[model samples]
Structures are given as C-alpha cells and as structure tokens.
Target: MNASEANFDGIVGPTHNYGGLSEGNLASTRNEGQASSPRQAALEGFAKMKSLADRGLIQGVMPPQERPFLPQLRAMGFTGSDSEVLQSAAREAPRFLKLVSSSSHMWAANAAMVSPSADTADGRVHFTPANLLTTPHRGIEGPQTQRALSRIFADESRFAVHDTLPMQPMFADEGAANHVRLCEAHGDAGVELLVWGREGLGAYEGRFPARQTLESCEAIVRRHGLSARRTVLAQQARQAIEAGAFHNDVVCVGTRQALFYHEQAFEQTARVQDAVRDAADGLFDPVFVEVPASAVSLNDAITSYLFNSQLLEIPGEDRLVLLAPEETRENAATRAYCEALIASNGPIGAVEFADVRQSMRNGGGPACLRLRVVLTDAEHAAVLPSCLMSDELYARLCQWAETHYRDRLDPADLADPQLMTEAHTALDALTGILGLGGDFYAFQRV
Candidate 1:
C-alpha cells in the first residue's frame, strides 16, 4: 500500500505501481560505480531471478515489460549478480509453501513483508500450474517471468508448488481453469488456490462480472464439497454498537474474504450482501459475521493493506501472527479480532505491533510482505513445536543483515553478493529448520 506521505518523486510511486515506465529508472546506467540506479538494480535482480527460473530454483516470474516500474527499480539496487540472485531466490523457496491464494500483484509481490515482493519470499508464491494461464499486462514479458521463475527456484534445497489458473480475459469463461487450480492447491498443503472469478463478487476492472466470482466459489464447493465445518461473516456485522463492527475497512476471521465497495458500484449493497450469503450457502455452511448499517458505504480501502485482518483464516488453536506499526490507529473491530486471538492463548497465537517503519517506507506491511511456509502438522511437530521459532526467521535475518551488510550497504543494495549472501545464508538456515512444502506454493512474476 502506498502511504499518504510517500516520496512520490523517489523511485517508488504511483507511476511505477500503475505500470508506467519512466526515464528516472533507466536514465542512470551501470556506468557509475558500485552503487546502481533503480532500473539497473531491478534489471540485475531480474537477470539473477531469470537464472534461478532457468534452473528451476524458483517457480514464477514477472515479465519486465509489464512492470514498467523496472527502470526505477533498477535504480534502487534491488537486483543482484546473476549467481547472488539465484541464491536469494533459493533461500526464499521454503517460505512460499504456506500460501494458498493471493491478489494478482499483491500476493505475487508479497507486498507487505520485508522480502522482495517482485520475487518470491516467505508467505508469497507466484508460480501457477500449467492449468492456470497467466494474465498478460502491458509491459510484462516472457523473459521477465522466466528469470523471475528461476530466481524463485534458485535454491535447490528448498522447493514448493503453486497451482495457478490462467488469466483469461474478463469476458472469457474461466470456471474450468479456476476449478482446476483450486483442486491442485486443495490436494496439497492447507493452501487453497483461488481465481478472481466475478460470479457474485461484483465487477473487477469493469471486466469480470460478479457472477463469475460467484460461479468460481460455487465450483469450489461442488468439486471439493464444503468441509463439515464452515462459518460465514459479513464485513459490517456488529455484535455491539462501537465495539462490534467499525465503519472503516475490516476483515472477517471466518471466511477470509475482504468485502467492501469496489471502485465501481456492485448493483446495490443489499445485492452484494445477498450474493455473499448465497455463495456461502452454496459452498459451505453459513455463519455470517454481520456488518453494521454504519459500515455500509461506497469507498475503496487499499485492498493490499487488509492482509492480516482479511486474508488469514487460521484454524482453531493454531496461532496467527500480525506485525503492524503500533502508532497507527488500528480499527476497533480489527483490534477486537486480535484480542480474540490473545484471549484464547489456546495455542492460537498472535504477535502484535512490531515496528517496521523503515521497511514500510519501502512500500509494504506485515501481511503485505510476509509469506507463510507451512510445514505439515507432522513437520511442525518435529522441529520447533513452538510457533515462536517460526516467527523468528524475520528477526534472525535482520540480525544477520545488521552485522554483515546494513552498516556498509543501503537496504536497496541487498542484491550484492557479499551482502545478500549473508541474507541468503540466514534464510537458508531458517527454511531448513522450517521445511517448506513441495508443489504447494510457487514464486513467479506476474
């Protein structure tokens, strides 16, 4: 999510985010010394990422042309020497296993965490199975994706699988593709593959209809058939007045679906709500989390910002971690949800309010950036039983970074071999202990 007080003039900005390539990025070439320009850095990173993909070290990629922001990214020194890029991608492999679903760029980039979003990292997987066709954007290209995939697969020791449905035009029928990817994801680890089907969700990009999303949900139900236990919740549902549901954006703990007015109206509020209910009914048992009347309105909250509250649907007794800035005024309802986790202490864990301001300045948040590499119940039981260890990877990498590179190199210079090797080693150790899954998640470009 782009902060309101962001330095738009810097390498990162709306222009880059919206797929616009600018002179600022590529204007400065590698003719300079050790420091690289944003475009140069991104290109270097992609070159390495590509190598990893070629070797099958990582699973996904992002065509450079489509990114448009590549030129600016190059300036940031985000890329690495070819070998180092492969190592970096290899180190991140294990973390992508836990992811089941994500937004087009959001999940692929792992936009919230400290790791590189354009490439794969913990909790973010980008590769889609052959069953799922990739969507084509304006400037993104094949080599970009190929290299990105290589970077994702760079580490031979770490492996993961991701099932992706093809990105068909909004007007095309993608139900079959959606069903196929979902099935693949479902069969593996707890991750569940998803499609941006429009069935009942409303129009997206003014293309795919709400009906398509609903239809996709329906397909999931019909194919897998809902589990015996499934609960539903509404975005505006309020158990109490001020405490229950806040008008601002909030996520439902049950369904793991984000609900709010999109850029365009979805027929009517009641209609959208009804569609949600119907979809729930068709797919799983309904336990609607009611949305209060006050919550009703037309506005678009940064969808990428709602990861912790919206996307996570952890099962009972399993802890859920949320890392956010404490100073930021969190929504009351969202706070309540976190409180619920704390109150349970029922093996359902929660880590609250970690300060990552500098990280956020780079663009991303806890969920936006972090990808969970879930070990099987068997795997978790074997290694560190306590989830706390799982949470320490980020900090551990930070410590390694501070001791080895931070004092000498800028955060943007992480792609350097000597510097990033420390990071890669730290990550390698973490993934080894954590044990990422196979065919459950992938790291690829969009």
Candidate 2:
C-alpha cells in the first residue's frame, strides 16, 4: 500500500460548538432596557439573523432545521415571521452553512491526502449525503461522518477513516465517563483511529482532569500503540498575553511566538530575528516569524493563542488570512479567516468559516474543535517493545474481542460507563489487535 493508503491520517475538525446555538434565545430573554457591548450586540445581531432564519425569514441562508428541533424552538417563546425577508437574507448571506443544527455547520478534513484502509478485504469507499454526519455527537446521531468513514474505507487497500465524535451533554470542565469508555474501545479495535485533544473537551458533556484524558490516551497508547501524533500539550504564540500552555498550546513550525513585546508591528520583526537563533526543529517556518508587518493585538493574540498553534498545521498562505484580521467580531473574524483561506496560494481546500464561527459561538476555534488520533504501524507496537510479535497477536485479539464485546458495546453505549466496562472486559478477545502486553482499557457502557 502507498503511504496514503497505509496511513490515512488527516485533520478532520469542527469549530468550537459554543455560544452561537443559544444567541437568539439569549437576545430575546434580556430586558430591552439593558445596555450591551459590541460583542454582545454582535451576538444579538447574529441571534437576530438566526432567529429570522428560523422563522423562515432567512430560509436557505440559515442552517437547515430538523423537524423535532423546531417545536423546541417554538416552545421557547421564539415567535418570528415566515415572510419574504428570508429570501433577502439568503441572498445576502454567505453560500456556506453557519452554526446551526443541520445545514449550518460543516466538517472538513486536511487536504494533504486521502487514503484507503488496508484491513478491508475490498479496496473501495463510497459516501452519500445521508450518512455523512452519523459518526457521533452529544445528542444527535447524524450520518454525515458515517458516510465519510464509508467512503474512506471503501476498499481493503484504503486506510480506514473514522470519526471521533465528542461525548455529548455539555460541561465546562468534566466529561461523562462514557466518553472515556469510547476512547478505550476505539483504540483497542485497532481499525478506527480516534481524534482528540483540548479542543474536544468543550464538546464533551462534563469536565474531567486533563491528566485523566492524558492517562486515557496513555492507556490506548500502551494497548494499541499510537498511530499518529496525538497529544494536546503544546504552547502556542500570542503577542502579549501569557501563553495558554495548560491547554496544550505549543509553538509549531509555520508560526512564531514574539520574543519581545512592542506596539508597532515593525519593531516586532526584530524580536522574530532574535528568536530565530534557537530554530532547531522546523520552528522558524514563516508562520512563526513575528515579522513587523503585523503585531498581534490582544484579541488577535487570543485568536492566535487559540488557533495557529503547534497542534495544527495551517499553510503559510492560509495562515496570513487568520493573522490579518483587525476586528475581533465573530463575523469579521470569520470573514477574515475564510478570506485568508480563499486567497491562499497553497493547495488547501475550501474552508467555510461559518462552521468555525458557529464552533466559536460554542467556545473554541478550529483547533479547539478537534482531537488527535495517532495511527501507528504495529498492532501491538506499544507492547512487545518491537513490531515483529504484534501481527499474529493482534489478529487473535481482534477475533476474540469482536464476538465477545460486539454485542455489548455499541457506539451509543459510549454514553454509559456501565456498558463501557462490560465492553472492555471482552476486549481481551482481540489480543492480536496490538502487540502490547500492558493492561488494556475496555469499552464498558455506563
């Protein structure tokens, strides 16, 4: 198999899924006498647009609504219109989807390569719109991701692509134990690679310790062996703000952190020069150069702090778009971010910033919205200390785990720790899945 087929590792990320969903409700609930800030006003405006869209006033311009979700919106006292305003809004709106339930948000994968799964008997992948988002979510189970997975692993020669869905229910900090259970299962399966990181925390229902997450990852790595670089522990650059190293922000190749602080962008260039001396690991890429052309502002610094970090690889050309934004407004930031991408001179694909905007509405940017799942070459590479003994052992484990755990731990069971545990116990059936001799974490639904 070619590199693409052997390792179909790609960045398929979503924007942070915060604030946008309830902006309309938030705007309507407030007293008319209350004052609002520009950020609040912008949110209110966005809320209004979404509100108008919901009432059919903005129709195609807004995200596609689900039949069941509509009643919930109406019950919430959101009475609007179904007039012709929708056509106008739709016309003026961007062609891409926004932060909505159905049609509004989008999912994108890195464009570097598309691969096929080697484990499959046949080497073909196909997808339809219906199954696209079906992989997983907090409440909804859309088929979009399923379709993507299907297409990615259509044939045996393809690298099996899987969707890493966030364990739902929303929590600022802890996540349901079930989500952790799912992580265990996917890792042991040795087929489906899961993505995760600090960004994934926002999507989970409850909060858990970062150590808990790291430990969980350690569990997977110990059992199945990590396939790709999967960790959320890096520090990214920001102009003046103290870096958010707690969230795994790290300096990456294309971007740079300011060595010295200055109001003027030109003065900042000198710091970039000073910092370049320690350029050991591809750290001096253009994105990291704190050039004088644009000094990172407070908000811009925050934007950069959350995004353009070591965890993600934004092309230099596309990187400029995010770096050039002056206004921190959600809409403006989204516009500039997308524009930079559209204007890129690289081989990147289309990125509808609406999805990102919607994600931000929830709380995180693009980087905060994804998880990392490393794909390794050995099934049991983490064990055995070498790759040779893993192949036979891994195959044996797969068969045992499949028959024993398949019935108990369905994907939906990832929500229940009880069930997840049951699933994990059965995982020994597939010892061949990995060569690792360490203890395994199974998927027992709670």
Candidate 3:
C-alpha cells in the first residue's frame, strides 16, 4: 500500500499579537512589544498552504481556537459578564489575560505527535496532543487541541486519538516539533527518532529552558505501541538549547531516508547515527547531511531558520526539496550555503523560500506552521473532507480573513472587550467553514 504525507497547517488566529510568552524562544522575546498585522499574518499562512496544494502535495487546514479564552478567565475567579470580565482582567492582571489570548496555536508543529498506521502496532493512526507544560500560555492548548484533532480524525476504526500525558515537569512533551520519522517511503515501516531536551526533572545548566523530557518520549512510544527495535532516543545538545534552538525541528528535519541537521543538534551525534543505522538496517540506508558549525554557526542557523524547513519528497521528483523560510535567503551565510548545497548534487536538490515573515518574527518558520501526518489512501479518505485544502477553500479563507481579522493589533488592543467579540465571531464562522460544528468552541458549549 502506498501512502503520502499531508501537512495540516493551523490557520493564524484572529488575536495574533506579540506578548513575549515563550521564555526560551529568542525571536518571540526580542519582538515582544512590537505591533502585529493579524490580517496579513493569516493571509500569509493561507498563501503558503495554497502554494503547497497547487504543487500536487496534500495540504490540510486546522482552524484556530477561540481567543480571549473567557472560560479560563472566569475560572480564575473573575466574576462578571464577558465584557466586564475582560475589563477586570485588564485592570487587575493584564499578563494573565495576554497568556490566555495568545495565538501561538498557529504553530501546529507543536500540536501533536502522530504515528502512521504503517508504524503503529494496531494498524491505525495514533495522535497524542502535546502537554506543552513548559509554558503557561501553551499549556492551556492541550484540551482544545485534543478536541480539534478528535473532530478532524473522527473515525475510530481508522484513527486512535489518545489523551495527553499528565501535565508535570517530568512529562513535558512538545509534540512533533521534537520528533522525526525516516524510511525509504511514506508507506514503509520507518525508524522513529524521539528527541528529548532533558531527562525527567533533571538539571539543565543552559541559559534557556529544555522543554521535552526523556520520560515523555518513552511514555509516548509506549502509548503508541511503537516497535522498540525501530525506535531510537537521542538528547538535544545543551549548547543548541542555549543558542535558542528551542525544539529539535529548529536544528533538524527528516523525510524519507535523509536527515538534514546542524552538527551541534544532538549531544551524542555519532551514537544517534549508529542507532539509526542499526534500526534502519533492512529498511533503508539513512542519509545524514550534517552542517558543520564552522560553515554556519548555531546563532546563524537559529536566526535564518535554515533547518526549520519542510523537507519534501515531491511526487515525480527524483530528489528532495527544502521548503525554507525567506529569512534563509536574506542571511548572507545561509544564502551562500544554500547556493553551494544546490550545486553540490546532494539528496536535497532544490531550496525554495516562503515569505512567512509574520511567523518568522515570532520564532516559527515554514516547518513550525504545519504538522506532518503520513496516511495511506484509505486513511486520507477517512479524514474530514472540508478540513482538507482545496482551491475553493483557499479563496474562501482569504475572504474570511479579510472580513474578520484586524489590520493591525497592538498588545494593548487585547484589553478591548470588542476584540473578544470579534475573535469569537470569526471562530464561529470558521467552524462552519471547516464543518467542525457550532459547539467546537468552549463558549459555544456553554
């Protein structure tokens, strides 16, 4: 049976703004107080999805969660109407309000870790929404993420959606952004690479926090019933973390048999390679493309997001293509390296840049914007039809964003009670667009 990889990109939410919530993410912190263009941001994301779909690739859309998460505010003992609650929170605790209103969910790569039916023991796709316990803003996304995933992959006979791990420091999981799967083809049994930032409750002496834990990786593997023989665990380099490579995907990405990564990406690079070779023994010969620090320093890689790219094995193409961010081309060092790479006649034959500067400013790039899920024809068909990207959907989404999103949003704008109304109204309309039903949002359930 042949299967293909689908990129399910989260649509940029209506409340897109800069709050500097992620402590370890340098870009987010650096651009904290800057105003954002929510309308342009959403349009850029939609354009990227449409481009991929036009290129004969499978692209899907994940609608954003309702913003100004009033339920969470109400839970915090803020008693009043929705507008009054917003006013009270703004007057009393603006930081808490910003945390709940964050549009970080646009980065779908951190949404979940997916195991294709080809790799799972039960022959069904499995999804485990990340606990994201390292940050208060992201930690609140699990419940909504689970609900959204469940709605999209509703066929229990073909898809198994599991609950998130317990929310504890010992089980901090950051989803597919910290995971990679490599094989000869999408349908083949693959080698699963589970990357962790630290061991359970262990001390990390780096300047930045290590989000993924070793115990969480093991728990996900066990819950997904992955083959132990084909699973390899590796720790992320503390140095990379200190340099602001918050997720493994920031410094590494894999597709088919090729792994493109910065040399400093793993603590024990040789051991990781050897384990991968052993696991992929009869399956496929792993191709490792290591970029030395001398060529492109860790700082340059993080700034340009060179490795935070979607490495795609496009249909009818003999070699892979790197869907990189436009920032990679703008940076002198990374640009020169990309030119040399294309001329080197390597497995990665071409490098294309996407203009997702809105997302790039906040520490997410092309890879960060989407979650990759490999599915066979039947499994693909099992997915909700409206959720899949199409020419019609793209046009509709563009118009929808123009109609609902604000042209410019300052951090202070979050305090306005009308913004909350606008966000909920947009989300309510989006549920209809995605066919997710009226009660998809918490407000609707109430």
Candidate 4:
C-alpha cells in the first residue's frame, strides 16, 4: 500500500468574516467585528493549494459549508421566509445572526478526523465529521459536513464515512485539530496521536475552554477501529491553552516521520515524544524538532503560528518544507528561530511563506486550513475529480470566487439579504463545479 498524503484545503466561503466567535482562539477574539475580504480570503486559500499542487504534491480541495445559517435561527425560534428570518434575527438577536454567518469552516482541519487505510482495521480510509461542540457557531457545521464528506468519499470499497459524534460536552471533538498521524512513509502503519486538554474543571483555568476531551479522543479511536498499540494519547499543557493555543495543531504538527513542536506543547513533552518514538520503532526513525520556550515562547508560537506550519517532505529532497504564514516571517522572535532551524540543516530544510493573513487573523494558520488524508493511488482516483487540484480547476475556482464572493464584509453585513443570496448563489455554482449534486447545500434544497 505505498501511498502519498494529499492535503485537502477548504476553499474559503463567500461569507468569510471575523465575528470573534471563538472564545479560546486569541486571533479570532482580537480581530472581532472587523471587516473581511471574502474574495481575497478565497483566493489566498486556493493559492496555497495550487502552490502545493505545482510542487507535485497530491493536493485536494474541500468545499466550504454554507453560511448565514437560517435553519439554526429558525430552531432558536425565529421563523418566516428566508429574508424575514434574517431580518428578524438581525433585529432581535444581532449577535446570534453574526455567529451563524461565520465562515470558520475555511479552516478545514476542523472538518473531520481522517484515518488512512494504513491505520484503520478495515484497510479503508475513514472520515468522521467533527461535532465541534466547543463553540456555538462551529457546532452547526457537523450535519452539513457529514453530507459533504460522504458525497466526496462515497466509495464503499475504499472509503468509510462515519457519522459525527453526538454534540455533547463530555464528547467534544475538534477533528484533526486535536489529532495527528506520523509514519515512516505514507503507506506504512502509523501512530495516531490524540491530544486532549483539561480533563475536568478547576483544571488550570485558562480563561478558555479546552475543546477536545480525553473521552472524545478515546471514542474516535474506537469508532475508527484503530489499534491501541499504534496510538499515543497526550494531554495539552494548560500553559499553552492559556497562551491561545486552543487546538494542539496551533502548537505542534506531525507528518510522515517528523514532529515539529513547541516546548510547551504538551504537559509532559519529553514523555510524549518518547512514546511516539517507541510506537514508531521498526517503522521509521522519528525526527523531532523542539523549539524550546527560551527561543520561542508559547505566546509567540501561537501568535505567529510557527509550529502550525505544514511539515511536508519536499518534492525531491530528503528534508521537509515548512509552509508557514507571512506572520511567522514578520514576527521577530519566530523569524529568528525559523531561520536558525532551517540553518541547522535538520529535518526542516526550507521555509516557504504564504499570505493567508485573512484566515490567520481569525485564528487559523496554514496547517489549520487543510485536512491531511493519506491515500493510495486507487483511493485518490476514486474521489471526485473536481475535489482534486489541477491547473484548469485552479483557474476555474479563482473565477468563481471573484464572481461570487464579496470584496468586504462587516458584522452589519451578516444581516443583508443579498449576502445570504450571494452565498447561496456561490454555493449553487460550486456544487456543479465540484460535481456535487444539486441538493448538496441547504439553500439548493430550498
């Protein structure tokens, strides 16, 4: 089962905006109520995917979920025609309306927990949509995400699409944001690392909620039918969480044989790495790059998202490349450490910066904007063609974004009937472009 991991980035939606909805995510809070460029956001996201595709890496795209969630408002007791619902909700519960319109799904890493065939019991790749019970806005993404994933990975023989976990606090899950997979090679058996934070209350009060629970991770492992021997569970440090590293990916990321992390990433960083090393024995030599808190503090790591950079094996080199945000290059401390890390000639050979500041301004970095799925050639080919990245597809997507997405959106804009219409019109065209059926989105069904 020799394979390659494809990076499936979520195309930023036409309603992309900063509502500062995420309580624990510092960037989101800092940029709260700010005007955003939906068009620029989508273009930047596509560029990142195209960059990877041009580099000859397997690259894919995840469609964004529909926004201006009217159904949610209806459930909350606002009822009437589509425009009426938006108007009433806007007039009565303006804040709630803004929360529903958030395009947080642009950060695709939270879309699902992926288990490659190499790690699953059935030898079939698995996709489980996240419940995202940690936040009010994100919690609504599950049902639609489930439908979208099942449509893309529909083949029964090669893919298994699991239902989202119940939206409960004890079983809260943040998808791939709290999960990582490391292997000697894409095709080899690997270790699935699940990171949990704050098992109980009075647990190092971080002024933010630790989204993923130990119970939630365990539930996913069982549902995915992963081998316990090949699994490593670690607790996220409260220090990192308080510093605004809400998800584990914000402080660490792993791919193939390399694990890039910050010193304060986990509660017992040494033991966590030791466990990973032991689990990977006979598989591949694990490469560990730890940025000591002395060189780059947790606050800097979260602020710049240096650790959130993608650690992809370069096209023709033995070393990895760090696909980071421009913020990392501009930040004094992170930039210095990044330069020194590459100069050290370690597993990381070079650092490439992408301008994804739109998403980054709302708490998502490069790694946060994509979901990693390891697929065999057959499995890869089985996915919908439009979901995969190609030159023709890239050009088409760019055109689509420009025509459908707005140039600017503010909190007040969430209530605009035209914004809702624009999102629906865009998603409608998108379904056809991606070969997703007419009924893929809620608006289409209407």
Candidate 5:
C-alpha cells in the first residue's frame, strides 16, 4: 500500500471567540468573557501547519464551520428574520445562543476517528465523525462535519466517510481525540488504540463529565473493520478526567511507534502497554515514552499540556520531535521535562515550541489542532490540492485571515447581524481559495 499520514487542521473561523462552552476544559472555563483575536488565532494555526509542511509532513486544512449559527437557532424554534433569530435567542436564551455560537470546531482532533487503508477491510480509509453528544454545542456539528468530510473525501473508491456515530449517549464518540495509532511507518498496518473515557452503558458519572464511551470505541472498531489482533481498548483514568483531561489527546499522543504519554494517562497503564506489545507481536517493537508523575505531576501535565504535544518522527530525521504549545516551553516544570526528554537517549530527539496562545486560551494545544489521517498514494492524491500546505498556499491563507477575520471578538458580538453577514461573506470567498465547491457549507447550500 502506498500510504501516507496527513494532518488536517481546522482553519480558525472568522467568528472565533472565547465562549467557555466546553465544561470539562479548564482553559475554556477560565478564559470566559475574554476578547479574542481571530486574525492572530488563524495566523498562529497557519504557522503550525506550515512548520509541519516545512519538515516534509503532509498537511491539509479543514475549513471552519459557520458561526453565529442562525440556522440552528431557527431549528430550535426561533422565528422571523435571521436578525430576529439572533435577537430573540440573545434576549430570551442568551446562554444557549453563546453556546451555539462557539467556534469549538477549530479543534479538529474531535472531528473523526479514522482507520487507515492498511487496517481496513476493503482497503479504503474509513472516517466516522464523533457524535459529540456530551456537549450540546458540539453535538450540532455532526451533520456539517459529515458534509465537510464527505466533500473532502469525495472519492469513495479510496475513502469511506461514514456518518457520525449514533447520537445516543450510550454511543457518544469523541473521535480521534480519544484514539491513538502506532505503527512502524505511516504505510504499515498499525495498532489502533481506542481510549474510552467511561463505560458507555454504565450508571452514574464523575465530577467532570466523561466525553467518550466504551461502547462507542467498540462500534468504531467493528465499523472500521480493524483487525482484532491489531486493536486494543483502554479506559481513561478517572483522575485524568477529573483533572481536566477531557480527551485522551490531552493526556497522551502516539505517533509512529512511540506512545508518548504521562504516567496517569490510562486507568491501568501497565496493562495497556502489555496489550500494545501483544498486538504488535509480529509487526515491530513499540517505543514507550512514559513520563512519570514525579517527573511531571498530573497537575503540571494538565496545566502545561506537556503530554498534549504532537510527537512525530521528523520526516527525514527519523528521530522524534515534540511540537508543543509555547506554554509547554514556558512552564518551568514542563520545560524542564521537555529538555530532559530530548537529552535522554530516547526516541524523542527534538522539541519545537509554537505561539498558539489564542487556541491554547480556548483549551486547544498543538495536537488538539490536528486530525491525523493515514492515506495511501491514490487516496492522498484525491485530497483537495488547494487545502494542502505550501509556501504559496500559506501566504494566501495568511492574507485571507488578515483580510476577513476580526481584530477582537467578544461573546456579546454573537448577536450582531453585521458579524453574521461578514462571516458569511468571508466563508464564501474561502470556498474559492480552498477549491471547495460553493455548496461545501450549509449556508452556501442555502
């Protein structure tokens, strides 16, 4: 199989703001009501994508969803014109309006769970959008996300873009944010590690809500037709979830063969490791970079997002590189651990820090900004060329952000009709630049 791994990052939308809509995310709740810079956010995200592309990694872009979601409000029983919909929602249901207007889709990691061609039954890469039933705001993204994924993966011969997993709470899927894939190379048949936050059908819940469910993980495995031998399921530790590790990507990130994670990432770390080794018995030996709690306390790990960084084998170097947020390098404890990690004779040889403060303020880190998809040669070619990162495309996108995005956005601005008009106009222009058809978005279809 001529396969390659592509990281598709969501473009920060024009209406990007600090809504504090995610209940389990510390940063989101802590930064509520703060003004946001959409231009800066998009620029910073673009820089991350460009850096990966510069290192020879294949990078793609997912367009942002429409914001100030009047369509959703109308569906929720708001009447009259779009302006009335916004005003009535603002006047009668302000909190709900704020939640629905959130631009949380920028965290593309939650977009879907993907199984590569090497791990699929029909040799087609499979995509199942996470139902996101735990969050009412995010739950609305399912249909649109499917539309976008279907458009991007239009070639059914090479891809299988399935609908979002069932919308019920029992099958609440959080997509790749809670999943990990490890293999010798992007083309190899890798081990798929499904991390469920809690038992889907279990009774009672934790202090902080668990977003992914065990039943959802099993459903993904069966639907993807992943080999039972190469698949392993693990539950996220209750402590991690309580500590604001809402998604597995917040506590661990696996790339190639290295499972870079914190000591408290899973409920039974040793058992998970053993299962990984057993699954990869014939494929290859797995590299485990387990960061002990004493080295980086659970608090420090969550605070600095040390484990949430992207751990990948540098395209040509073969040595692993950790692309983390500036916070990881700025936090004294996490920075120290990062230095020690690279200094040690381990698989990780380099650490790169980026200024993604805008996204971080909204509870997104480097790894949170991407959805990794391993695609074969033909499958890769089918991706929209304009969405791929290059010097030219990066420059264009930077210009697009500067030209269309706002300098500062506040929660109150969600009610502004002018803002909605501007967002629609900007997204309309974006379709042309991304080579997405005019009808790629819900609004565009209207």
Candidate 6:
C-alpha cells in the first residue's frame, strides 16, 4: 500500500482578473484594478503541472468554477436574463458584480482538506471542501468545489467526500491553507497539524481578518475521524496575521517529516513543535527548519512567498525540493536565504522557482495553487483519469486555453455581457475536456 501525494491544481479561468476582493492579501490589494491576461495565466498554470508531471510526480487538474456566478446575482434580486443581470449589476452595484465575477478559485489550496487513507479511521481517503466563509467571493466556491471533488474522487470504497461544514462565521474554514501533515513516508500514518487564527466566538483586533477558526479544525478532525493522539492544533501568530500572512501557508509549509516555516508562524512556536513531536513520537522525528525573522523578516517572507513554496520529495532526489514562486528568486533577502538553505546540507536539497506571476498578482504562490491528496495505488487508480495530467491532456488544455480564454481582461470588462457569455461557453466546453458532466456549472444546470 505504498502511497504518493498528488497535487491537483486549479486551472486559471477565462474570467481571470484583478478584483482585489480578498481583504488581507497584500498582492491582491496592491494589484487591484489592473488588466490581466487570462490566456497567459492559464498557460503558466499548465506549465507548472507539466513540469511536475515531467518530474514523475502525479499532477491532477481541477476545473475553475463558473464566474459572474449568475445565480448569486439572481438571488440578490437582480432580475431578468443572464445578460440583463450583468448589465443591471454593472450599472447599479459595480462593486458587487466584481466580487461575484472573481476568479480567485484558481488557488486550489483552499479547495478542501484531505486526509490520506493511512490516517483516516476507515482506511479511505477523505475530503471535506472548505466553506471559505471569511470572504464573500470565496464563500461562493464551496458548492462547486464539493461537486468537483465528489466527481473526481467518486469511487465509494476508495474515497469519501464529505459535505462542507456549516457556512457560518463560527465555522470559518480555509482548508489546507491552514493545515499540514508530517510523516516518515507518504504511506505512513502522519501527524496532522491544524493551525487556527482566532477562536470562533473570540474577538480579534488585528489589522487583518483571522480566517481559520479552532472550532473548524476540530470539526474536520471529528468528521474525518482522525486520531486525537496524532493531531496537533496551534494558533497562528497574531503578528504574522496583521503582517499579511492571511493564511498559515503564507508563513509555513510541511512535507513528509520536515516543517519549513518562518519564526513567527505560530504564537507559541516551541509548544507547537513539541506537540507535533509528541504526536509523532514513535512514528518519526519531525524536522523543524525555522527561518529566523532576522534572516528573512515576516514582511519579506510574505512578500516573496518563500514559505508558500511546495516542499516535494522528487523521485531521484534524496532530499526534498522547494518549488517556490518566481517572486522568491526576485526578492533579494529570500533569494539569499534559499541559496543559503540549499547549500547548508539540509532536508531541502534543491530550490526551484516557478513563474506564476498572474496568480502571484492575486496573492497566490506555488503552494496556494494546489491541493495535495495522498493516495495509495488503489486509491490513485480509482481517480478519474481525465482529471489527471498527461502529455496529451496538457496539450489539449493548452489549446483549450488559447482557443477559449481572453488575451486580456480588466475590471471594466466584468460588466460586459460578452465576458459572461464567453466564460459560460469556455466552461461548458471545459466540462467535456475534464469529463465533468454538462450540468456541472450553475448556468449548465438549467
């Protein structure tokens, strides 16, 4: 029952633009109202998947959700046909239209929380889509994410897809962005580390909103039936949150038994490490690779998204590789830190930079654009073949993006009825490409 982790990355949608709907994301806020190239964005995302697949790592794809989310507009009392709804919303409430038309789902790390078969009680891979209740634009993603996950991981005996937790502020879940698992091997029973920003009912006076709640983490643990002895819950540093580390992943990431993070990633850093070590007592000794604040300040780390890189166990590599965003390479401090880190003979043997500037502009890095699901051979075989990446699939996806996606899209373009039509048409064809049924989207449902 040897297992390996698969990264399912969300395809950048046709409506990709800088909406700046995310409050605490500095990049998103900074790049607000800028024109975006949907064609380039989608292609860049595909290149990342192709690169990983070329390295013999399993790469999967998740289709983007339907944008302009017409149903939401209709629910908000915007009457008439789809085109009319777009026009009316544009004329009356332009800001609301931009929020609903956001393509932020391209960051799939917030798609769901997954537990490998070795860790779950039933010996099955489990998924619970995040409610994403912190932001209105992202909150609309739960239903579609649930549908997509259920469809891709449809086999009953091998996988279990649970409904999202109650969509309440009390149960504000941001999925894997605030979660990590450390293990000796991909197949081994791992210690799950769930990070929380604030208590559900507690007040936080931080400059930014605290997304993941302690109660939400507990709920997922209960739903997945994870062993209490093998779980560790830690609070995200308040300083880090206010510093624009909106999600814990912004300041930390873990793979296998190595936890690479910033110094201020957690409130009680030593205790969190001790708890993780205790949970992993007999299994494996956890490696803590802490990047001191002096070496790479919290602002530098967040700005460069150095910690948001993916730590991977490549096939031939003895040590893990850090797949970071191009921003890390561009930033002087993070670049020096990476050079020092790889040369130090540590668990991270190599550092690779990926050009995901389109996503980066919207505050997502290499790690944010993916959802990791560890699966045994049997569970892997059970996944929908079309959802997995192949050379042929990549080619087809590239052609699809070039043919369907716009070369450029601006905030003003969101008001055009044409953009909505183009989005629906592209997504409709994409359903066939991904083997998602025709009724996969809200517009297609009718």
Whole-model Cα lDDT per candidate?
Answer: 0.27, 0.25, 0.94, 0.89, 0.89, 0.94
Q: Which stretches of candidate 2 lie over 4 Å from their true place?
A: 1-144, 162-212, 219-298, 303-446
Off by over 4 Å in 1: 1-162, 167-363, 370-396, 403-446
| Deviation (Å) of 317 in candidate 3 | 2.0
lDDT of 1 at 59: 17
Off by over 4 Å in 6: none
What is candidate 1's lDDT per residue for 297-403, written digit by digit as tens? 21111222322221232334244333333322254544454465357533325534634322233223333222232223232223222112222533442343334
Clashes found in each candidate (C-alpha, N, C closer than 3 A): 80, 98, 0, 0, 0, 0
How big is the positional error of residue 52 in model 4, measured in Å on the Cα after superposition?
0.7
| Candidate 5 lDDT tens digits, 67-106 | 8777889888999988888899999999878877788898
Shift in Å, residue 101, candidate 4? 0.2
The TM-scores of all predictions, comma-separated, are 0.38, 0.30, 0.99, 0.98, 0.98, 0.99
Candidate with better TM-score, 2 vs 5: 5
Which is better, 1 or 5, measured by lDDT?
Answer: 5
Task: Residues 146-265, candidate 2: write the lDDT tens digits.
Answer: 433333233323233333223331211111110111111121211222112323234322222221132233333333233333211121222222322112221111212212122321
Q: Which scores higher on TM-score, 3 or 4?
A: 3
Per-residue accuracy of model 3 over 146-233 as CA lDDT, tens digit each: 9999999999999999999999889999999999999998999999999999998667666889999999999999999999999999
Better of 1 and 4 by TM-score: 4
Error of 6 at 260 (Å): 0.1
TM-score, cand. 4: 0.98
Model 4: lDDT of residue 218: 85
True-structure lDDT of candidate 1 = 0.27
